[model samples]
Target: MTEKSMLVVSAHSADFVWRAGGAIALHKKNGYRVKVVCLSFGERGESAKLWRKGPDMTIEKVKAARREEALAAAENLGAECEFFDLGDYPLRVSDEALLRLVDVYRDVQPAFVLSHSQKDPYNFDHPLAMHVAQEARIIAQAEGHNPGQKIVGAPPVYAFEPHQTEQCEWIPNTFLDITEVWDVKRRAIECMAGQEHLWEYYTRVAQQRGVQAKRNIGITVKRDIQYAEGYMRLTPAVVGDLS
Candidate 1:
């Protein structure tokens, strides 16, 4: 049997750590090699904490700090991290960048993919990342898209929960009970020193999702879930048996 792999595409360096660290850690524990692609370092817009350190912070400085944080976070989750370094603030995904993502899709040949929500009013970059991820997935599956490169298999794509779920129109259709890996996720969350305010917020989100997961299906399984992550599957799942 072939080895299973998972891929996650994020708009910013810290986005994956905040949204999908639990899922990444859980899958890695289950013998899947996970890869993360960060479109940008979010240096300009998302580095408020670093920026507040007086006027000495340069773009390079911010990028370096965010990259370090992201690397630490990915390491905590047992995943490999790649950075595109595309500038943010008004995060734009160029055609070249999209092609790079296509290359990643072909290279990883991920069994499943995770990305941002399709719509996010608070951060347009989040939705843009989703668009690029979707397009890259489609292109990667087509043999003719790149003449010399081998096409990749179709993988189910799941969008992780956004910060403001209601505003983003993100509904959680899948809940992963990550109770056992919550500590790992917490450690990953702490790696983002530039975004200290979000640590507790995401932790609370996990707990709330865990409560919802418990009410929804935990009772049936007779399991107690203290932490969970929610996702919206964007692709059809094929299985030998529905159960």
Candidate 2:
């Protein structure tokens, strides 16, 4: 319900959809822009879903389809998307990679930066993304550290919940209300025909979180609400009570 650009970095292309699409859509509808940076196209990460399409699809073709699906999904959510094309599975964040990512942080300088939680179920890009983003936070703030970095003044940064709750350490202090934009979120997710199965998969996750939020606040967050996204402010975001 606020107006400010947000940058989301994910370990894979479809991640922004399954985990954070609702928030992305809500952000855009509220006059907040968004940019998603995927560390990989998920080439080696997992392709059984994509391969189920047919036996003839090549690796390149699957990757291309994923990018197409992601771009379409992002647009539907009112956000733009980009992929670093880093090989998935065993993504390594080189010192140079850290510098490069910081470059993007500098260029976008989004009011809020989002990325994977440091904890994840798998042993791959999720942790790499978390580490890279964490380093970027510091590198972006490091004066004269890399004059070549493309972003601008540092913005508020946040960490998002991962796909597997138990695998990653996700300590979310902020729960965004996507009830108003839930439909738009659903529509955006549908764009990922490649991940239709995930719809049913994540719906439950959303419901669980919604119930948790309501219990914590002692208010019922309607059942029509099927999805939500969570985050923890890396920097304090104080409204009215600036004390």
| Candidate with the greatest lDDT versus the true structure | 1
Candidates' C-alpha lDDT = 0.93, 0.74
lDDT of 1 by residue, 133-163 (tens): 9999999988789788878888999999998
Candidate 2 structure quality by residue, lDDT tens digits, 1-243: 634677888888888887788888887887887888888878666556778767787889888988888888888888878788877777766677667777777766678778777767665677678778777877787778756545455576677777665656677787766777777777777877776777876767766766666665655544444345677667766678854
TM-scores for all predictions: 0.96, 0.85
lDDT of 1 at 206: 96
lDDT of 1 at 202: 96
Which segments of candidate 2 are over 4 A away from where they belong? 1-3, 53-55, 146-154, 220-226, 234-243
Best candidate (score: TM-score): 1
RMSD (Å) per prediction? 1.2, 3.4
